[model samples]
Target: MTLPSLLKRALADLWNDLGTHMLTTVVIFLSALIFSFFSLIYFNLQNFVEHFGTELGLVIYLNKATPQDRIPALYQKLAGLEGVQAVVYISPDAAFKRLASYLKDEKDVLKGVDPKFLPPSFELRINRAVFHLDRLKRLAEKINRWPEVTKVQYGQEWLNKLKRFSVLLRAVVLISGLLLVLSSAFVVSNTIKLTVYAREQEMEILRLVGATNGFIQGPFLIEAFFQGLLGSGLALAFLYAGYRYVETLMGASCLLKGVNISFLPWTFIGIILFGSIFLCVSGTALAMRRFLRL
Candidate 1:
């Protein structure tokens, strides 16, 4: 049969059974929505982790009595260290100014502060490739032993917690994603089976008239394709609306002041659409196979 003929027949079938098709579409939509929601969470978490990684570094505070002349040598030594990408020296005045900027809203708190009381420091940007906890700990320990250094701070506890949380999040996403796929396919397959059963008599008539399996299944597959496309598209639209609403609601909240929430990327959007269509078609094919014994 021609593609146009198949589409026409599919449309006719859909119009004749609008109620059933609507229900099936709703099922697909809900399934896609749930899956997409979790995927969005994982995507954001991954982005946050990467951003944190890029910003991760060490701050080496100098002793108050450390010689001012030793700073240049200390900067070069840190720059030459393995896994150190760059070393920036922060003078006492610069550090003091930064602290003041942070506390600008509470200016009275710094009224009696002196820049001389603030220690100078070196901020070391570490190479991402070697940004492991153990490696960072080793580096911090070695730097802490320096006579000119007062302390080395790298937020080791926070990084360790983040690493553990990231691993757990990945595992949960993987397991739940598999479960969602299987459950969605099962539900869709069963729904499509009912659709096939409803038209069993017509299929029998076609078979008796010597119709090929492909010819008999073409319209049904096309119908499934339309359902999948409509359902997935609507699901994405609804999800985006909800995402935007939440984002707007949180935009002014102090808790999320510096955080950025983004929508799914084009690659993920394409995957969800393609996966929805594939699932629907595969489900219909499975139902047709069982009914036709083909």
Candidate 2:
């Protein structure tokens, strides 16, 4: 049969069982929405991690006994280190000023504080190409052993926590996404099976009249395709609406003050839509295989 004829048959069959088809679509819609929600969270979190990585650097404090003349040499040595993009020396006075700036209105707390007590430090910006926790730790350890260095800090605890969180989130998204996909396919398969069973006698009649399996399966597959398209489309729309609402609400609060949480990109959106359609089609094919014994 022609494409148009197949589509017409599919639409008629769906119309005949409108309630069941709508319910099936709704189920698929919910599944897709949840899966997309997880994906969006994962995407934003990964982006944040990468952004943090780009800004990741080490701060090495110099001992008070370290001579001011030795600072230039120390800076040169640090700049030569692997993964060191740049090295900037912050003198005690500059460090004190930075502290005061951070304190803003609370600067009164530093009225009795002396800049001489503040240690001079080297700020080392790391190269993104060589950025890694292990490498950073090694660099820090090596720097800390220097006679002029008092301490080396790169927010190790915070970085470690962020890394662990990213890994855990990824695992959760993957495991949950897999479970959701399987469950969705199972639901779609069962729903299609019901439709197939209802038309078993008709399909048998067509088969006896020498109809090819492809010809018999075309309409059901098309029906499944429509179900997937509609369900996924609606899911995305709803997800986007929810995303905007949350974004707007968060914008007015300090919760995500400096953070920008974005919606799923176009590429991810396309993938979800395609995956949903493929999932439904595969489910329908499975149903056809079992019921029609093809």
Candidate 3:
């Protein structure tokens, strides 16, 4: 069939079967939307986990009488170490300043506590990529041996748990999303098959009349594809609306006092659209295969 003729037939088919096609498309679209939203969330959570892990390390607290002049030398000693990337010194005065600044919002409480009571410390950030754990531990031990070194804080037990959980969470999210997408495709496929069955006699007659394979099934395939596209588009619209609504309602909630997460980036948005297209295509192909045989 000519392109124009095929397109005309396709449009007519879609119009005639609008009700059923619409339902199939809507189902697939909804599936894609739910999958995209949770996948976005999973990626964001993985980012959070990595950032948290990167910040994990030792906090070396210095002794009360550690002289100001020796602070730089101590810092240099640690900085020059094989595993140490950089050393940030927090003097007693600086520590007090940070504490006071944090408590500044509570004026009454800020006035009561002496900031001088806070200890001087070094915020040690190591190059874990190059730093051997045993060597780093030894350096910490050497630093702690000094009379002017009060304590050494190293190794968080939660590191393993956090990493493991992040992996598990991503796996769960992906698997669940995939299974749901398949279920949606199945629903859509069955819907399209029923729509095709409604006009099975007409299809057989076209076959008997020597209609080309493309000529006979092209309209049905086109109709199925249109449904999938329309459904996915609606689902995307709904997801965006719901995301915006939730952000507005809970933007200032107390539960997220420390979290500063945002919605998925534009790349993810593109991925969602592409993923929707793929699901729609797959469902259409499956439904059309069965219908074509019948």
Give lDDT tens digits, candidate 1, residues 1-294.
888988888999999999888877888898888888887887887777656754868999999888889888998889999999989899999988888898888857877778778999999998887766678889999999999998999877777787778778877877876887788888888888888999999999999888988889999999899889988899999999999988997788999867788899999899889988999998899889865764
* Full ranking by lDDT: 2, 1, 3
Runs off by more than 4 Å, candidate 1: 63-65, 80-86, 93-118, 125-150, 252-257
Instruction: Using lDDT as the measure, name the better of candidate 1 and candidate 3.
Output: 1
Answer with 1 or 3, whichever has the higher TM-score. 1
- Go through the candidates in order and give each one's C-alpha lDDT: 0.86, 0.87, 0.72
Considering only N, C-alpha and C atoms within 3 Å, which residue pairs clash in candidate 3?
A: none
C-alpha RMSD of each candidate structure in angstroms = 3.5, 2.6, 5.3
Q: lDDT winner among the candidates?
A: 2
For model 3, residues 171-228, the per-residue Cα lDDT tens digits are 8878978898779867876786787678878878887888767877777666665666
User: Residue 247 CA error for candidate 3 (Å)?
Assistant: 3.3
Q: How many backbone clashes does candidate 2 have?
A: 0
Model 3 — TM-score against the truth?
0.70
Greater-lDDT candidate between 1 and 2: 2
